[model samples]
Target: MKGQHVTITSEWTPREGERYVLGEGPRFVDGQPLIVDILSGRLIDSDSGRTLIQIDEPLGAVAPLTGRNGWIAAAGTGIALIDPDGVEWLAKPEVSADTPMRMNDGVADPMGRFWAGSMAYDNRPGAGSLYRVGVDRTVDRVLNDLTVPNGPAFSNDGSVMYLADSARGVIFRFDVDTTLGDLGPAVEWVRVEGGSPDGMCVDENDHLWSAVWGGSRIDRYAPDGTRTASVPVPVTQPTAVLITPDKRILVTSASFGFDQPQVDDGAVFVAETTVAAAPAARYGPSN
Candidate 1:
């Protein structure tokens, strides 16, 4: 079946006393989506808006969470192990930071390591960082001093790691040392004009798909970063995206960033395509 984009959730639905501020990290597990509301640190079940789990911190601002066993690797802080009953226990990040939370978009690599990005809380450009956490609890800094470092997704072969710096409006490519859990010097992979790039994913064909926050669209690019096509959306702020295990395109959007009337304007959208999708990667531990 080809990939398709459609809206499955209502626009700006309220959940756990919070409306969708910034939506990122949409992952399909067990036939349902696990999503994070960035401003509130709430992990929600897409089908019901039930607060499945809560991050025990102030403004946790989580995005692109990957689940494995009982753990969730939350963007901004570190890995959060969610017990079977929906309680979260956080594992401290290996990289030290003055800010309370700095992580952004992340995903589990094909080799089972969690790759996430961090940026200065005050939105300082070029002060963000990236890290990799292995299943055995080993954490290593792979990149540093990024301005709004966000999405980190790997190619189908696991040879290339695509990292995006939102403030720079560009996505970069790095040579991945999978066995070492390391990333090499980044080469400019793709650039977008007038739009900030947020979360990203790799399709079955190894194409890079990125969500543009202000651009109201998702873009597909070839491995070398050539623009393939753009998919328009109803909401202006698209925070994260994923291609489901069955190849359905799921998008999480935001209503909080613009205005009050706009706060509930966001919606979780889906689209269908004939193309298939790669299986989602995994993270380790529950807490």
Candidate 2:
């Protein structure tokens, strides 16, 4: 059932830091928010504005390794592991250089499998794909013929997955085979109307929260695919949303397409929310 509209304009305030050209992938790890400056390929601590690491290519997202002191990240053309030493490539797409695709949003599922999606630089239709990296470090193309794939958020028990095709303004739901990390059939879940969905996260109640790129808002959806609430954002482009463990909402924005950007256009914003989020799942063996 649809609920009353809740506008949250006064609660949001920008986090201290220099603005980002393309700020994205807000994830809470060890009680701190880690964000990515996508085009710059820099992963940063949102609170301190400290660069954790910067690579030569675009960095989409990262998840902490379960059994090691490092990170498994969706970067450039494939997935890589980052540590104090340096980055070691785990897998790369087989597509030729002429295709020119780069990784976008990604995360590790509750079962510790890493999944990432990629899109062509030119935004060509049907040129994007979603890949899954298993516990044994095998990369498999799970879905193809996508344009601007985002989110791919999962349910708490790893039984369901939700993915958005931003360019198509649609979010899809899928059943997951938890033991084998195989997806069942894709079902149309939500077709966004006003704004294209960007990045998303699932809350403790299994509700999905998405950052709407062009609508100046973040939307919350019930598990049954009903739009229940919407939180207004100060910036025009809210690239991603994270529900912090402390029950706060963290959003990353972008200044990429704006000619005269607002003061908070590319800033990270934080808000106090009633909902709580579980800690992100780590990549690798579960202890």
Candidate 3:
């Protein structure tokens, strides 16, 4: 790893009996960094460690990619609009009743399309898939037979997308169409040996920062997937990574169901870095 020494420290810590319970899907909207407590199904304001809204459903991913009226979330088996009024599904998922697929980590492209993935509840192999919801509200299955799908991020120009299949321990890249949300053939990007890649965020310079679940560290990768830097955390599972507006990288950790938890298991951390974040993409009616 070649870079300046970045300072990583805790940003939010739970109370004695509190647990974050799988923190994931972090995004900055209008400068407010919103994070999801996946298990608890709460959208949190990362700045104050407060719950902004509660949706007692399975929250796979939440990002204001549409950049319109309300944020979009993969709630239950489908994606929905969660605003002050209420929640409404834009397009219902076509999952079979017998399948145990649940939505997981996701992101929006520069052209304003939301992409999310799913995985089986029991980590069943080949029971998950990746879906791309276009700005015009059309849902298309981009990839299938995935396991533990996560980290669907893109470069600023939308010419490249980085996706991770956690169960396979690999992150793959695809050439992308920024406007139509088309994915090209997949190619190997990187492989995390010590842990699985969870959520990721791309910086303004096009470098990818990946959170390694169960590895207690976040590694920075160049556009070519070469590791350039890393920041270690105190907990075992760092689930997601986000770059704030001010260039501070914020990390989400988990301690949800552990019998014995580490002190920082449920705490969120921030790293002081010199890289700026790529501007968040908006999802709306493609005009």
Clashing pairs in 3: 65-283, 66-283
Error of 1 at 171 (Å): 0.1
Q: What shift in Å separates residue 184 of candidate 1 from its native position after superposition?
A: 2.3
Summarize candidate 3's per-residue lDDT along 97-147 as a digit string, tens digits: 356667788777777788888788888888888888877777788898788
In angstroms, give how far residue 58 of model 1 lies from its true place.
6.2
**Winner by lDDT between candidate 2 and candidate 1:** 2
Q: After superposition, how far is residue 103 of candidate 2 from its true place, in Å?
A: 0.3
Best candidate, lDDT-wise?
2
Full-model lDDT, candidate 1 = 0.69
Residues 171-252 of candidate 1: C-alpha lDDT, one tens digit per residue = 9999988787767888988888758888888877788889998898788888777777777766778877778766567788
- Comparing 1 with 3 on lDDT, the higher-scoring candidate is 3
Candidate 2 weakest ten by summed lDDT: 1-10
lDDT of 3 at 187: 93
Each prediction's total of clashing residue pairs, residues at least 3 apart in sequence or on different chains, is: 24, 0, 2
TM-score for candidate 2: 0.96
Instruction: Give all TM-scores, in the order shown.
Output: 0.83, 0.96, 0.91
> Which residue pairs in candidate 2 have backbone atoms (N, alpha carbon, C) closer than 3 angstroms, thus clashing?
none
